[model samples]
Target: MFRVAVICLALSFSLLHAETDVEENDIDIEDESELRSKFEKFKVQYKKKYDQAEEEKRFQIFVENLKASKRMQEQDIGTAIYGITKFSDMSDEEFGAFYLNPVISNNNDPRPEEMLSADVAEQLTNVSLPSFVDWRKLGAVTRVKDQGLRCGSCWAFGSVANIESMWYIKTKKLRALSEQEILDCDFRSTGCHGGHPDNAFRAVIQLGGIMSEREYPYRGRNGHCAFKQSKAIAKIQTYRNIRPDEEEMKIWVAHSGPIVISMNATGLQGYRRGIIRPGAYACDNFRLNHVMLVVGYGTSRGYPYWIIKNSWGADWGEKGYFRIYRGEGACGINKLPITVVI
Candidate 1:
């Protein structure tokens, strides 16, 4: 009963945003000297070492991204704060190539007949929904992971996270599962390029189970399959897609476990912290390019947000996590939510 209610809430936030546009000059321009100084500081902070020619090229890109971040801050309707991040030095195209996976958004494959669909109603009935849910607090969530610039493997990380939490929820044992195994053995996906979470889940079942991170550590790039059946640690029987309702998603998170979701990550490159609620121009709902884990949800100072676990390392947004506006399908978040059955 509770699972049904939760799925409904998750779907509500997936369709509330209307498409809109913003002017190109929405950002505030800063002095050149000040911008340069900040760039130097950014380099020092991130330990960035570049040749003279590359330094100049990267500095210009950094400046442009700074302006873009400022524009996002000014045009944002929610309380999201934007600034320089580890990705600030890369251009939009570079960032997309390095981190975002296009296959997820372009995937048109039919759902498998054997794959179970989430049994959820459109709205809550007698089951009471919690106002908040945080799987990290419940010890079901693992530490934030880093996918690195070498691979666009957020799909593997997202699926692994969901499986880890579900495995813990069922067995009372939390294990950092191996995404490298999927990156290498999941022939259904293009290693270091992109993949679909459902594909990862299916591959897990086919491969018997996944190994622990210690046994099959991530290399941030494609490698020959080194999966040892003897070291397999966690497994899933099947996977389910939640109803496209935000309310139901919330209920599901509160009652079940974390969910693997794909969304538009255009505005995430410069995100520092705070709940991001950007306009459609900044974060298009139809442009889903990145996959992440929905660990929990709650309201922040009147702004309802989904606590998302990103695979961008602990130095990024909210210590390797980010919060997106709820009930609005922000960044196409509710477009594709899938979880595993352990």
Candidate 2:
């Protein structure tokens, strides 16, 4: 229930822009320097409240982890806070919009329903494993480069990709499906890309199957849909929802399968390599601007990693993917499951 509320909260706030009309009115009396001062004050207050809550709830665990890691230090917290709150260029309204507006508007989206259906339960029973699966050990998995194709269906693609990866682990075969097949065929789908993974899952189940991208072909493109290839698609056995639990994720390689998640993409999305500095260092404290697949978890070099595959083209970020540290309690994306047509 609380989990559903969090998802709803994120979705609602995800819609705000930094330069909305309401922002102008909100900071009309303050200049840029004054705005920075106010923002700093607010950040200090926010950080204090955040730290206190975290420490009170999990001080022993957090401190123990810090002690064991050696890499952990008070400096880590200071650096993260400093990095997040260091900006000073915006006017008061813009600065306010950057932080406060999204949080305030987040209240508008109602909480999502928490009911679990009989069909969902049956599917879960049949498809889910008794054992925890470590995705990094899974052999020869494939990555899908979903063309968002001007649709907001990144969420759907993310969900499907994670499911597909799981399917590969269980079935030892790779199958690519056309997003269009699911889009046009699924009645639950909001047309022109305005849909979520739930709709995609229902659509696949409704069709009773989906096709391989090779047979139907993605075309890195969209076109008129044909129902002929539906037979090639597979039916899902069942699935699970693994919401991001920072602690569960600490040993996550042993606790879950592939995960679908979303985040704010750094605008420097197209460049494949080099250190990516998302100019203003925006979104360090924000959430849900982009969706992605968490295919595996491991330590890259010495840093813990969330092996993420993105929708951007192949030229972007380590073969259309990148790794972020699974530390400092950042990147807590919801991981849901989809079943392969078996």
Candidate 3:
């Protein structure tokens, strides 16, 4: 009786191992079915979200890809369909097929000469401010916009705008500072391609500072800057201007408040770079377009970076806000300016 019981136990253990082998063998085949089902379900769900015509068209394309994939080896089919399904969910801008095309070439090479050569002095020699150039010092607190023109003047617009905002913050008055004020009034900065915070700061100081937009409404399109007394609103009062060193920038930022500064961001235009990836802020390859107003800097992914505002209109990146690579001289390597009301 004991021998018979032991033999029965051994037989049961062998059966269990055999069952496990069968389960493992079935997994590969199961994977194919699971993948196919997943695609089918995804298609159905996607169809419901889109209009019938668009859905049908998309479905047809997906079907064609899936069928074509089947002719390849099973392994290839799994990989290809995985990619195909992902492509289906992407928005128009997210699509990378055009980027893959070799026909796309660099827009013009960076010409430092073209970027720096400005006719500000030639154009503005005759234009003069009113007897009283009322330049109001506005606030630095502003809603930064990502106006990804790829022209990269966003830094100039933002920094100058914040400088102008000091007028508002000081006297509870709103002033439209001149982007062209800095552009035309200062030979140091060439619009947006290349310039520094100090350039804008020095320009504001030399031009007897800036005036309100009521005195000078902005003509968005580029033209010869015409200064008129009829446009004269108020003049700005200059307080103590300090170009803070890197350590001083931090001190100023910590003690004072928001300040604008420039940074380098590659392909930051239109934000094709995926959802500000988890650890991407730590990346070192960002490019800088000289901007001003250093607000603050801190660590994000165990690495430090700047929290600078942009001027790319409200429609652009991260709602006109972006992260600058920290500690990389992205914002003048710690040599950024701090301005206050006089």
Candidate 4:
């Protein structure tokens, strides 16, 4: 559910800029100087010290980000607060190609629906829901933060991470699962291009589970499957879809383990830090393209939010974690939630 929201979020934002060009040469000298001054100050505050060799390249990207920042601020569009960050050095195209991957295949066209069995999604209205849950802090998920790099295999990473978390919960072992295994072997998915995490999970089960990362390092690109039966470290007998209800999702995560979800992540690209609540940006307007895990749920500033774990590397956005507004189907977050039945 949340996955669709994220997928849509990224896709809409990407589509909005696909045919446009960034013209940077016409900046007035005064404005350019001010932007440079702000960028320099931001760099100092963040300790993003660029020595002489990287200055020219860094400055170019900084200028682009500065222009974007001013434009966004001037329009006063949406509620997300934008600023220069570690990613202030990468252009939108480079960032989209590298760190951002929205599911762009046919599955993206009609808006995805629950595919597996006709088993109507169960309503967990009677389920015991917790007010707060933090799986990362509780030690159920032992893996460290991960980076998807240039691959569009967030589906693979999200699925593998959940399986790995289940391994820890059931067997008391934390083995980093091989996402590369899925990237290479999962024919049902599109590897680095885009894929459904649900399909990736099905691939894992059919392949008799996955191996540790030590057995197969992530190539961030599609390659031959080198899955070794002897190296299998984690397994999922079956995976099921979670009810597309926010309350039910909280109950599941708090009681069971982390689950993969989707939501509008377009705003996340510019996120520096803080809880995200979209204003003026509605869910119906975006497309779902990205996939990630819902690690936990909590509140800040008296507002409820979901603590989502992204695969865009720890260097991005709050150490690769984000909090989106909870309830009212935040950015269509409670849309197509799925979990593994290990």
Superposed model 1: Cα runs more than 4 Å off:
1-28, 103-118
lDDT-better candidate, 3 vs 4 = 4
Name the weakest run of 10 consecutive residues (lDDT summed) in model 2.
4-13
Best by lDDT: 1
Better of 2 and 4 by TM-score: 4
Model 1 TM:
0.88
| lDDT on C-alpha atoms for all candidate structures | 0.77, 0.43, 0.39, 0.66
Model 2 per-residue lDDT tens digits across residues 1-342: 221111110101111121221111133222546444444453443232335654333323322222322222222322111111111222334323332122212334323434222333434434533232335456524553645334444555665675566666567776665566765666654544344565666666666666766666544233455657336655575544433453343333343456665554432222223222222333353444455666665553455556677664443345556665554334334322222333
lDDT for model 2, please: 0.43
For every model shown, what is its TM-score relative to the native structure?
0.88, 0.54, 0.46, 0.77
Per-residue lDDT of 31-53 in model 3, one digit per residue for the tens? 55654455466555323356768
Top candidate on TM-score is: 1
Candidate 3 lDDT for residue 61: 55
Candidate 1 lDDT: 0.77
lDDT of 4 by residue, 140-220 (tens): 774544543456677777788788877788888878888889989889767877777777888888889798888898767
Clashing pairs in 2: 176-213, 210-233, 211-233, 234-341, 235-341, 263-290, 272-317
Residues 1-342, candidate 1: write the lDDT tens digits.
111000000000111111111112323446777677777767776678899999999989988888888888888889887876777788988876656644332335555544434356534665688888999999999998887646777888888999999999999999999989998999977867777787888899998999999999988778999988888989899888776678778877988899988888878888877899987577777667777899999998999999999887777778879999999998888877789988
Superposed Cα RMSD, model 4 = 7.3
